[model samples]
Target: MSNYPKTALVINCGSSSVKFAVLDPTDGHVFLNGIGEALGLEDARISWKHSGGEKTETPLGAGAGHDKALAFLVNNILADDKALLDSIVACGHRIVQGGDIYSQPTLIDDEVEENIKKVIPFAPLHNPAHLLGIDAARENFPNIPHVAVFDTAFHQTMPPKAYRYAIPEEFYTDLHLRKYGAHGTSHMFIAQEAAKMLGKPLEETCLITCHMGNGASVSAVKNGKCVDTSMGLTPLDGLIMGTRCGSIDPSVVFFLCERLHKTPQEVEKIFNKESGMMAVSGVSSDFRPIVAGIQEGNERCTLALQMYAYRLAKFIASYYVPLGHVDAIVFSGGVGENGPTTRKYVCSELEEAFGIKIDNDANYKARVYMGVDHQVISKPDSSVKLFVIATNEELMIARSAMQFVK
Candidate 1:
């Protein structure tokens, strides 16, 4: 190991899962990475893999919550690697929604913790879990500096016009009701990477970033700042996701309540958990199965894929309004980087309209160069360039956290 400390512990705690990684941010190498999942119930388990070893899984005890799960990870997996643990100088957390108060990675303090608690209403499932992870990790590794990296921090650069809702002013001013986009860290990272790929300064580059996965969102980055994004108020407002009904008419809720006799809670559940590709394809929420179904002559799956691509294309086109000229259209996240068919379909519609022509062979070859680095897929003569960049939210978190410790 180097004489100076060069590692950071990154924590991403979800509603029922805790994902942690020990990384060397300078070289982008993961010493150890793992996740504790199925939290708070029997059969809760922790699985992890070392850099050069096979993955290992162990059953956590019954009723293991986020705190207990993180404790087990630090005590069991990380404790054995004293060198790696000792080299870690900071801990970075992924806070889903920071509301309007936070705009950057903040050092964890009592006031910071309180503000995070205050935003629970905006991120009911995520904020509470993040608090658990933060509390547990702080206690488990008391000496290290801890930082809260808000996913909304990057999009804080969005102007009022882009983030504001059309409701009464008080709703936005008092109730804090407005668009606070998600996947901001991914979008920011990809935008910076795209700037580097173009050999231009980030402050002079303009780009559109598509972060597509189980949860999808697109952002318009003008001169390296987020001017607008697709997701609104919550992650549910973006492009159709694995299960979310993205960007539907607000009146649909009232319609469901009146005609279907569904409660508000029931309607929320349906929109967040029962819609999207799962409902459209009528098979599974996973894209792999949906794509497989399409190959097997399933019309519903075919339509689902088409609709997903269409919405993405439309969003890509609309973002151009904010960014008068885009240097590149970047694809990140799980599906964005790996789903060539989806990428092909999304670009096919924009080919003539946007002067973007995909090189089919280059698109297929790009999958081979997925993580950290990016691969360009648009033809040389195409007016607009297209690229597939693997997003590294953890690395971004680590980099932010490192600044505070320094």
Candidate 2:
């Protein structure tokens, strides 16, 4: 291995978006960060910025796709700055589902690529996009090593009891179906950060990590290992999110199909794309607007907020049964870091029962933009601590890739 410090290029691809970051893993210094969005659409565009520099957005004509967009990022963006491109040592791709086959980051090869393709059914919306970005990056930079960092890897430590669904045995044995949680990267990152803040070794720490955003999930981390998580089999099984109706009863699907005369695919679309906050509030899926609607005396919005908070609190309390004694409850991701009202609402009922009193003043200050990514929002005398930590999945992916390169 070379002694010189080198940057790691991290790629995260969604159905219609591609986010890339180049960072120096040793010091966590991001060199360049950008995204290409609205792929294949008339309004497709790419936006990027150098560290400490103003952002630049460029429109890509209607035919632009992932490969074309990635080429632009490399040939037009990084190529303009040769030094930065030359310093890149490896590439890391964030893969959503690795299935039971991959329990850790694996160096990508023909076999690994085939395995990734095989698991596409488990992550229909994510894995294909990831493969596109992976293939594009590999072709764009053929010399460097590339790694696939799975979002489901960290939660592989979950016990069978926590992951197993009470379904037919053949479904699991033949199809490899079970509750493989999502947001493992974010959950693992925050759990370690929370352990550091608590002045305890990760192996001895117990934490409840809430990764709340447009997509949300909570994990119970016991002594550095994941015990249980809210999301299961797919991301749709988690807490209520921007569009997903998390943890709905299976019978609801039957009702939609048999009673309402809706097809399975139609019901699936409604649950995954048209429900949750958007369905309940009938205003917006975003938390800010939902909270605003509550303040404006919208009953549906108020009920939506209450239901979201109640479910989150219930998950937190339920995890306590497995953890026995808790050290801290960590709030991370988009909404968790900025939405103090949501945080307050989530802990409202648990304050007395679980000793999770939120320090209103401190809770209101934990915003990523304010340089306060890590903060303790719990009352000083409270038995259980509460923290808000910014989740850094890209950095974590970079570090994971570094281990293989080194």
Task: For candidate 2, report its TM-score.
Answer: 0.97
* Candidate 2 lDDT (Cα, 0 to 1): 0.91
* 10 residues in a row with least lDDT, candidate 2: 1-10
What pairs collide in candidate 1? none
For residues 237-356, write the lDDT of model 1, one tens digit per residue: 979999999999999999999999999999999999999999999999888888899899999999999999999999989988999988999998888888888899899989889889
Which residues of candidate 2, in runs, are more than 4 Å off?
1-5
How close to the true structure is residue 370 of candidate 2, measured as C-alpha lDDT? 92
TM-score against native, each model: 0.97, 0.97
Model 1 worst lDDT window (10 residues)? 364-373
RMSD of 2: 2.0
